[model samples]
Target: MTEVDPLALDLPVLASLAGSAADEFLLARLRADGHEHIRRSHGYVFQRLIAGAPTVTELGAALGVTQQAASKAVIELEQLGYVERSADAADSRIRRIALTDRGREVVQLGRRLRAELEQTLLATVDPADAAAARRVLVALLAASGGLEAIAGRSVPLPSD
Candidate 1:
């Protein structure tokens, strides 16, 4: 008879703990740095903007939300001076949303913080283990239709 480690069966729990640690770290640091208005929800917009400037409709599609809801969020973020909306150069009738200087700064800060957190966590494990874990995560993400699909909505896990 062979014994299996109980912890080995809790991949979801382990992943959640790892993610929560990074989220808490960013939330605390951002708040301390006087960015109290930003919320995790805002990250959706921020990430999309980082990929490319998108119209409200496009953002809505990407985020799996209605255009009105996406527009409301954009308006709020615009008021906070984190994002700016302008007429599309190629399409005067279309409005595109982009990150303002402040928004860009916040995004850069997040990137830096995330890198630092990764380094801190990886330091506790063997380099090979960390690399292997990353590869697995990448594979999982790819298998699931990539980040856009995963970001758009939450679905119940399939029952075995």
Candidate 2:
């Protein structure tokens, strides 16, 4: 095994580590809540749906995936009873996907767990240091043109 050097870590690497840790924590909590079918990738779709229903094409564009891929994911989510698809009122040709009540519950639970995790971490570090970390992270996010720009990238990046 190669010896790892913490001093070689860069911003992108550190950010990715933070994301993976958060995803692991969230998925573990979701499993405890009886959502064994859900996976980390689905979090991107869920975050988009939480705002309101969006057509598969819109979802695909936001995540930088093909419509077919988005449709496939949505189909699995529908089969699992987390989301539902309906014909768009203004355009019957377009199908809009929305979270079901069960889906909303799952999203809410994830949000609650995330907040709790943040609080717990904040407690572990010095208050000033934690505040500085938040500023740096937020500035990095803003530098990338904010969440909207970040979410438009291809697979594997969590939207929220």
TM-score of each: 0.80, 0.83
Find the 10 residues in a row with the least total lDDT in model 2. Answer: 150-159
What does the lDDT read for residue 111 in candidate 2? Answer: 88
Report the C-alpha lDDT of model 2 over 19-72, residue by residue, as the tens digit.
888899889889988998889878878877877788998888766688898899
Alpha carbon lDDT at 139, candidate 1:
70
The 10-residue segment of model 1 with minimum total lDDT is 151-160
Mind giving the per-residue lDDT tens digits that candidate 1 earns over 50-99?
87889999888777788998899999999899999999999999999999
Q: Would you list the clashing residue pairs of candidate 2?
A: none
lDDT of 1: 0.80
Structure candidate 1, residue pairs in collision: none
Each prediction's total of clashing residue pairs, residues at least 3 apart in sequence or on different chains, is 0, 0
